[model samples]
Target: MLPFYSLLLIATWLVPKYCLVQLNEPFLYISATTFKFVLTSTLFLTKLKMKMSKFVCFITKKLQNLSIFVNPFWIQICYFISVSSVGFLVLKVLKPRNKSFRPNDFDVFFMSVSATTVSSMSTLEMEVFSDTQLTVLTILMVLGGEVFVSVLGLHWLNSKFKKQETQNKVIDPLVVSVEDLRYKSSIRYLSYVVWAYFLVIHIVGSTMISIYMSLVSSARNVLKNKGLHLVTFSMFTTVSTFTNCGFIPTNENMIVFSKHSGLLLILIPQILLGNTLYPPCLRFLIWVLWRLTKREELNYLLRMNFSDGIGYNHLLPFLHSCLLVVTVFGFIVIQFILFCCMEWNSEALKGLNCYQKLVAALFQSVNSRHTGESVVDLSIISPAILVLYVVMMYLPPYTTFLPRKNDEQSLRSNEKMKKRREKLVENLLFSQLSYLAIFIILICITEREKLREDPLNFTVLNIVIEVISAYGNVGFTTGYSCERQLKHDGYCKDAWYGFSGRWSNEGKLILILVMFFGRLKKFNMEGGKGWKLM
Candidate 1:
């Protein structure tokens, strides 16, 4: 913790000093804040690449000797790069790919981060990133809600290019066929269908919330400046939860006129947004049952699946998604209750209105799985709430978005051919489950004393929490940023010394990692062998 703060402070001072020194070179000159920002971004990208570098090289070498062109690691890397870039591209271009398809891992990762982080929470737009950058990112995130669909579109482009006799063919041949194309296309369409449920409910709810806030108690005076604030707020939130950025432009000190409008609009959308994203568990359930029952209809739908992948044909996706939903919401509800009963419960509601409190709870749950929106003052937030966040931060995405092959010989099953197939599946599944639990427990036990002492120590618990936070792209904090305020006088003084957001060097790095991890496929984090999600 001490090192963390010290490094941050040093960066704050050093970057500006360096920038000032470089000022004579007009082309190279930039603000200290911007320079620090780039430096932080570089640190994050470097670390992320380093984290996967070894694993990727190992997989590549193994595949090289065996003639598996375009190894799984390449797919994963491509998935990350594509998901991020394509989503930005599509929003502007209005390309051919629709929502019904499931994309490869890169596209999926893009969609996952786009959807989960809810980039709509971002206030910056044509004003901040240039009209093109804003428009591209927004559209990609808004329309491209699922990583799977993006993967589909990218693969299709590659396929068409391949046929056109392009130079490179990165996606393996198995992923190149028309059958795969149709299946994936169908999946993306279904995602839009899923969006329909979220859209309508979101529109109706957000509209009502906006109207209420616009006309409600103590709103008229303060809200006079930004009349369309409510409408834009609603739409942005729709984009946010739909995408999951959880960024709120208005908070306690700012946007008084739009206070309730901001909170209600921001929080409510996530409740439905989390449900709209990929339905991995549902697909999984369908996969297992489809295998055992040999149901003709189920098989046909999957065969005629509307998109690139067979996502809707199985119940596994639905089940897994339900688990994810429960895991996130369950933790939030439990924490909310615990907070309500705590001694400082009243303090939790210190200056917030009812809508704000509701928004805070919902935001907490939603961020548990995706992007974090820490609207409530963290200083007042009890340790219990932080614990809940830590717990959610460590829990893997309840649903494994990767396509599982339950065929005669899965990576897990082939090893135990001597054993019954069912026995092998059970053994592998349980063993991994056991491994996860033990590994987590060991990390906790090893770091328990540190956690107790500082609770904010960056140990295994912090690493685990960081990983999970990265998984959903939800940014969690002990008392980081504007999410909480100056209960500790020193922190308040630190704020006046410089802009908190500008000063946040390490925080920026953590955010980039979270954003990258935020887009990573759920199962990939679990260490499944020979299973390239893309």
Candidate 2:
């Protein structure tokens, strides 16, 4: 009965999205599923909570034993929205008037995996390739970003609401310090600003790519012919990749002279976003506003930390973000220098004047660290570069995942993050190279096809992609080949992604083994009471 109740509730939210897609745009229903889930879930959750205290109490208590289940409820809800939408979308494509199904599991899994990792692979690339693919990727990447930010926002909302509930009276402020995402008060206004910032960056990045296209296209002056899809593609690609959606639209086809700034723009933002720099920026803006308005209370509010008496942590989070960007940047730079000096064929680079070589350097600089979208041929790169790639791919950039002890007990998880960066970078300097050497040899020798396949098997290549995408959750497939050719019974993804980019089956098994190790990783030294004597 309990299982049945849960299933029914889930189905109620998703049934409309499935039917809606089947009714209209039936061909692209899976593509519509994620958003539709968001829409329907919002509606269902609203109605479920409306004057339904009994149902609420039933759910709240029944799930109390499973705190972890409830903890990630939002993630589950978001994922449910994402997966149901994809199912509807696939059905629309197969268009089963009677019910013969083509179970394209990889396509939908890739969609969910890509969204979770903020990657850019699409069934379209494996099917009828079009620029609209970028738009789909863009939406997924934004949802990924939204999930991260919303979780951060919820941390605030839960605390505030808990306090109010205890007092048994609402102390409402005209400008709320925090609210649910839908509530949109002045405090939540900052979230809107964050959204706008990302949108503008997406547009600017796309526009730059478009300009590059305009310069290189033979039909340069013809605005009517260039098409909005390209602009849309470029913008979405920029934000998608920046937000860590590793999908692409304009592949090897590029406007040689338009400007390579789009590539640079896309690359920089990954570092920026990966570092999660928005909170500090928001804090800065609040400080400026307080000073400008001459509001002492505003200044006091700014000074407050999540827990009492813990003062402002100005440099810790910034430094954490800096180390993350720097480590990735530095590692990728070494990879380029080594690859070019040791592996790159002399003939290709030899003919270049300093300027052309310089541009190629710029290209190399942007793509290697953040994404696997090498403008040049990946198959041709030196074995060492490929080996370097495997090493870089394993870095999971999360503030919460690493060691936590000795860390400051601040709500800003970034402090512990900074400490972990120091440890990983330091370990890499000493022991990681040998360990990486052994791992690389295993990959190259054991995974023969990853190295030797011409147009790599979509299934096999997905393993390579999954390994890389897991760390940063960026999904990009180099233009090695279209996925349809690599499909084995339409389930190449089963073959392609080896355990869902290290977030899946074998990866979890490996983690379970590692958990037995006596000590878990710890963070920055607390000095008895970090930033406090409390």
Residue 325 lDDT (model 1): 54
Q: At residue 212, give the lDDT of candidate 1.
A: 51
At residue 475, give the lDDT of candidate 2: 38
Q: Whole-model Cα lDDT per candidate?
A: 0.43, 0.42
Which runs in model 1 stand beyond 4 Å of their true positions?
1-76, 79-137, 143-231, 251-266, 275-329, 343-346, 352-363, 399-468, 478-511, 521-523, 528-534
TM-score of each: 0.50, 0.53
lDDT of 2: 0.42
**Worst window of 10 by summed lDDT in candidate 1:** 494-503
Looking at candidate 2, what is the lDDT of residue 207? 53
The count of backbone overlaps in candidate 2 is 16
Provide C-alpha RMSD values for all models, in order.
16.9, 13.1
lDDT of 2 at 74: 46
